[model samples]
Target: MKKTLLTFAVVLAIASASNAQTKIPPNIEKLLQKNTCLACHKVDVKLIGPAYKDVAKKKYKPEQIVELIKKPVPSNWPGYIPMAALPNVPADEALTIAKWITTLK
Candidate 1:
């Protein structure tokens, strides 16, 4: 019984830690999925693209982020491959995603 309780506690702790690490609002998550942004980005870890947290650290204005989404600047991220422009994304959607990204720690 004691071993079972300890295992449960450990599982609970890991679940809570995972939840705390990444919590995108449902609306933002919907937008990200719709935009296919999740293909290369994560809330806290680098995927094919830099993590949202790292982008947030740059402290870009929301509008700037929107522009970057439409027209990515390769020089700003030296090691990464140049991000292709996503001009097809609607302005409002891009702004919404950009604002959410800036809120990340």
Candidate 2:
């Protein structure tokens, strides 16, 4: 528990420092937990949807990424299962999230 707390503390510190550029806010983690976003999309390996690492490989501008996240284009990824839109996710916050996800590598 102590180690967990310390690790979480370190993450919080780094996250806070990088808050302005991060798509997932501290509170968003709670929402994501409830929404189960991680079940399909992971940081590295591809699951049901393309991995965040793969999305980053496309090298989209922040705004373009924001648009993609807002309305996931099924045709763009026809062979794979189409991603559903996440309307609950606000544009500004999603933009931050996309930018941060793209920086995973």
How large is the C-alpha RMSD of every model relative to the true structure?
A: 4.1, 8.8
Best by TM-score: 1
Regions of candidate 1 where Cα sits further than 4 Å from its true position: 1-20
TM-score of 1: 0.81
> What TM-score should be assigned to candidate 2?
0.63
51: Cα error in model 2, Å: 0.9
Give residue 64's lDDT in candidate 2 (0 to 100): 82
- TM-score per model over all chains: 0.81, 0.63
In the range 1-105, model 2's lDDT, one tens digit per residue, is 999999999999997786445344566565445556677876556889887778888888888877876688888776789887877776767776767766766
The candidate scoring highest on lDDT is 1
Q: How accurate is candidate 1 locally (lDDT)?
A: 0.91
